[model samples]
Structure formats: C-alpha cells, structure tokens
Target: MGRFRPGAETDRFGIRIAASGNGVHVTLCRPGRRPCIWLHLATAGTVADKATVDDRPEIAALARRAPRLEARALECVRNDRVLFHDLDAALEPGQVLQVEGPNGCGKTSLLRILCGLSLPGAGEVYWGDAPLPEVRAEYYEALAYVGHRHGVKGELTPIENLRFHRALAGGTPDRVPGDALAHLGLEGFEDVPCRTLSEGQRRRVALARLLMTRRPLWILDEPLTALDRSGVAVVEGLIRDHARSGGMVMITTHQAIRLEGCVLGRLRLGG
Candidate 1:
C-alpha cells in the first residue's frame, strides 16, 4: 500500500487516504497518537491515483479543508406534479440549517435530495463544488443521516443495536455504546429490546447513534419527533456542540430549537 496526501493541509478530522493493492485506505491521525487509526470509509470501486485525486480541486479541498454543501435551483417533484421549485441553499461548517413548511410542502423531499437519498427533478447538489454523484463515497464518509423512522431493530437491545451501528461504520467510535446510551438517557434501558421502550426512549436510541458517529455533516429529518422537553434539550445540546466543533447540520423540525453558540439558518419550503 502507498500513502497519498491530497495536500499539505489536513482534513477537518485529520484524515489521510492511501491506495492499497485492492482498494483505498482511509486513516485518521490524531495529535500525539503513535499510529494512525484506520477508517472504513467506503471507496466506490477503484479510486483515482494520487495525481488524479489531487488534480480535482473539489476532492483535494474536501480532503484537506473545511467542506460545504450546496443546492442550486433544486426542484422536487412527485407523481407528475411539481412539489417545489427553484430552491437554493448552502450549508457551511459550524452552521445549522432548519427546513420548515406546511405538510406536503416537500420538506422531506428537499432533505432527501440534499442527502443524496433522492434525485432532484432539476438542478444539482454539490459537496465542495463537485456534484454529489462524482464524490459520493467521500461525501458519504463525512455524512451522518437520521430520518423519521427510528431505524432500530425491535429485537435488538439498545446496546446491541448501537454496537451493530458501530460495526457498520467499520471504524472505532469516539464513545462506547454504554456511554452513548447514558448520554441519551437510555442508561437503564440499555440491555432491553428497543421494542419495549417508550416512543421517546426509542427516539433517544436513534439519536444516540449520532454520538458514536464521527461524521462531520448531519442530515436530520424531524429529529424532535417524539421527544419531550428534556429530550428536546438534549437534541439541541448535541447540535450546539456539533456546530461548535465545526460540524454542519441540516435538520427538519416542527418545534423551534435554540443553539446558543451556533449560527442557525432556516429554509422554508413552498413559502
């Protein structure tokens, strides 16, 4: 395997990519760490050679600098009718964007398009100046998505579910499963199947995954769905800390949220 540095500058998380005989390798280097840690960032098929990676300004800058997400003239459509059109927005590091509108105004559609889950009928979504399709693997590596569904297996205990989530990431998490559960107020329910938990508790479990994920961009859809006052505060605190740490967030919520130390922006659909 040969190591390649996109540039002398470091990525937001101090990551480096190396080309191996079979695929690309991503490593995280932390200050004072003797050896870099391997990250299981998916590389779609063969990666570009060192020169190729460096040649693309978008890819190079994404690997070596702060990143931005942009949508230009996005149009969301359903059936044969258009739901919304001409939407333009940009989300920068250390900023939170809230998407709001009446029911069926395409708030969910817009979020889906921005997160690459669905395609826009018109216009383009870019991650650091490159179209999302061209840099999918890299963009996904930096993204964490939480949608309307709880996304947890009913049969799996909270701890088991969390561990499975970490396994899928293919990287060591910053926090352990138990610690994450505790932080999300799931301490006593850690070993029980999520099916037995209350709606709010289950929602907490879903949101707890954010704590273990080290991704820089969070795309959340109705993150406050079933949470109560305290739970809502927890979600707000998480967003605040993430923004303070230079992470970007795009969220959809019916309830207003306050992030004291972070810049918050809003996009209203069908307005």
Candidate 2:
C-alpha cells in the first residue's frame, strides 16, 4: 500500500493495474463505479504486470523457496590468539552443518560472523567467493538468525509476534502467523499473550518463524533448549524440509540431531 497509484487499461482482461513500491498491483474496473475492486500482488525477485493469474501463483511459490548458503572463512584472531586459523568451510545446497563445542567456546561467535552481525577479528567471511560485507544486504535478505533468546515479546500474542517479525523482514504476513503457529502446535493459543505461555510455548513461537520466512540460511544457537520431545520433532522436521528445499542451515547445540541424506560436519572450538 506504500506509494501506489491506479490506472485505466484496455487490455483483453479488462482489468486495471496499479503501481506500488512492493510490486505490480492489479485492479478491476467497471463502467460507473470508481474502482470498486482492487488487489495487490507482490513478488520478491521481479515485477511484471503482464503475468497471468497462473504465473502469479508460480512466482509466489518460488518466493517461498529458500536460497543457498556459501560461507567461507579466511582467518580469525581474537585477543592476540588465533580463533579460527585459516578456517575455510563450504556448505553445499541442501546441507546442514553443526558447530559443536563446550561452553565458552567460539561457536556463537562464529555463527555471528557467518551471519555478518559481527565482523571476525581478523578473518574474512564469504558468500560464494565474495566477501560478506560486499553482499551483506543480500545475505540479510536470504538468511534468518535465531539466537538463544526467543525474540517474541511478552506482551504480544503468538500471532502478533510473527506478524511483527514478518513486517520487519519485508515478508507478507497474510499466512505467516497462521502457518507458523499451526506448525509449532500453537493453533489454539495463537491469540494468547506470550507472557501467559510456558517457556516451551514461548520457544515454539520463535521456532515458528522458520516456516514463515523465505530465507534460506538458518543460523540457530541452541534451537532446542526448551522443548519437549514433540516440540523437538517439529523443529527437526522443519530442518529436514528446509534442507530438502535447497536451504542451508548452521546450528550450534548441545543436543544431537540426526537426519538422513544430510551432510553433517562439526567444528570443535575449545579444549
């Protein structure tokens, strides 16, 4: 709805079109009524008005798919000591990599570096042979980072939290809240305030965002910290589906997760 304008058209479909910052906008025009009907269509990659109705669905489908991850490390130094000396790792499409180590190790730090939220002290992170800084925006557009803290606000309901996250991330919240809550087994409590929910339920809300975003790379720090068996299964299934859809995942957790057909690698940080 940001900066949109309507226009008349004489095309075969007899439908008027609108222009918006998000993407192409479509509207139906009648003889007398002043543009009684309107529809807004947004696509992630490109914009086009000539697309058919069927094409719109296809574009939406593509947007739900995840992108690939290509992170490499050149070197890393911290406190005059080498943290990751010439660390170089590449995760192919549809693969999952785990960073395992004891507490106080650099697992979280490395994840932050990969996410480009923090720069490595003396190393280079890359997204397909290109430095992360050069493509930081692109990385942000393609990645979703879930840190130790569940990012849900206590005052907001589960649905409201997800809606806020989707809006901030530039994603359509039309189905995100519903889909995420349902997937995380919070359908009945979707409207309940997060503060009223148990710790596990709060974690569920954060985990639900994984299904809603189109981001490919998921960097989770202790993603399963406060979940029961069922909750863990839900997250595990989501991870499998994410990898199957050509997405990349980097996780740091004490719990062991086993997935077939998933290439697993580990980085032991501390002694």
Candidate 3:
C-alpha cells in the first residue's frame, strides 16, 4: 500500500509523489543519496486501495522468514505420453535448482509449472507455507522469469526493453535501466535495436531485467543458450550471488556450470 498522497506532495520523510490517472509513482529518498525504488501505487483513490506485495499475509511471511518453493506430484502430459509423473521438488533460500536433462525431457515444462506459467496435471505448488494461489499476485512480485524466447522486443533498444520491464515490475530496485544494461556487458550496444544485436547480446538484454528488480525467485530457462564464455561466466556469477544472498534461482542449462557457495539441487524431468 502507499504511504503518501498524490499531487499534494508529502515530504514527511523525503518521499516524492506524482499522480497519474489511476496509479501513482513514488520515489523514496534519503539526504544526499540516490532515490530508492519508484514504487507503484495501484490506485489514486485511497492508501488502502494501493496494492503492495507486503499488504498480503503470504508475501509478508515470505519476506520476513525463510522462503521455500515446493512442488508436489507435478505431472505434465503431452498427447497421452507422461513427461513428468508424480514429480516432486523443493527449493529453499540460498539454493539453486538446476533442471537438467536431454532435449525433449520436459525441462521447460517443469520450470513453467514452478513459475505458474503452466499448471501441473496433478499436484500443487506452495510458497512459504501457503498454496501459490493464496499469494499469486504477491508471489509474482517476488518472482523473475526469463524463458527461452529471450523476452526482448526486436525493434526496441536494449535500454528501452530494460526500462519497459522496469515499468512492468513497478520499479528498478537496484540499478537503473542504463546502468543495468551496462552492467550486463551491453555498454555501447545499449542503443542498438535487439534485431541487430548478436544472439548473445540479445540474451544479455533479457538478463538485464535481473538487475532491474530484486525479486527473490528466478525462473530462468536456458539462460546460457546464446552466451559466449564470458557471458556465461557473468550469468553464473549472478546466479551465485543471488543464491549466496538467500535468493532462489531455478535454471535450466545443459552446459556445465559450477555455482560457488550455493546449495545446489538437480531435477531430471523425463527420467
């Protein structure tokens, strides 16, 4: 929920507020320091109407305590063939689940099921101690999904795409759009349209969103697909830091990647 009023500016604690038709954007700042997240206020009517991830019990518990993602008896069927049959897994804070298998092994399907992009044929997914549906919207706030498609707009520059994702997620909690692009090794290529960038560059643009938000759960599918050695190293390093700092990352990679200081878990989907 929002703590500031729109248009009528509130500087009680150096909070900057601006109003739009139905939503509000706020920048919380400290003396001589960069502003924090540009928060999204769901509505302009009342503070109670402003939706925040913490306004819900499920998300609040997740943030306040150790977060875990659990999948029980997850099953995926295709044309009467069982891809995943009664599959089960659990992911905790500071952990990485690397879904590994050969092609056509339903690795993507399992990850999709975990990310709520697809439903399981049999069991359920739990966030913290509650079912996913109990905290669906808030769960999304804490989740960052990067699929095989790269999720980039062909006509948009890397910076534009990153900024677009930032807006979608409410704000850039860490690096700004430009800095995130630069950090992902897309410095001079920031202004180039994705259509012109190499395969690896486009993947980097998609990954730049990771720096834009501080979501705890990362669902990445084949993040190493278009990366060169250096790019792969960068991605590995990001994954390591995320887990080390108590964030959870679920990745699908066929390449050999060693994550330092993480409790690694593996799942074979079609086995």
Q: Identify the leading candidate in terms of lDDT.
A: 1
Sort the predicted structures by lDDT, highest score first: 1, 3, 2
Per-candidate local distance difference test: 0.79, 0.69, 0.77
Q: TM-scores, in order shown?
A: 0.78, 0.71, 0.76
Q: Write the per-residue lDDT of candidate 3 for residues 1-271, one digit (tens) a residue.
A: 2233344443333455555565555665543468774566565455343445334433322332445899888888877778878888999876899998889889998888888888888889998888888889768878899999878999999988988898888733567888888778888998888999999899998998998987878999999997999999899999997776567899999899978678899887666
Stretches off by above 4 angstroms in model 2 are: 1-71, 74-82
Error of 3 at 258 (Å): 1.7
| Tens digit per residue, CA lDDT, model 2, 51-149 | 443445543333222334554554456677666655666766567888888876678778878888777776677775578888887678667889887
By TM-score, how accurate is candidate 3? 0.76
Name the top TM-score candidate.
1
Lowest lDDT sum, 10 consecutive residues, model 2, at 1-10
Ranking by TM-score: 1, 3, 2
Task: Write down the lDDT that model 2 would get.
Answer: 0.69
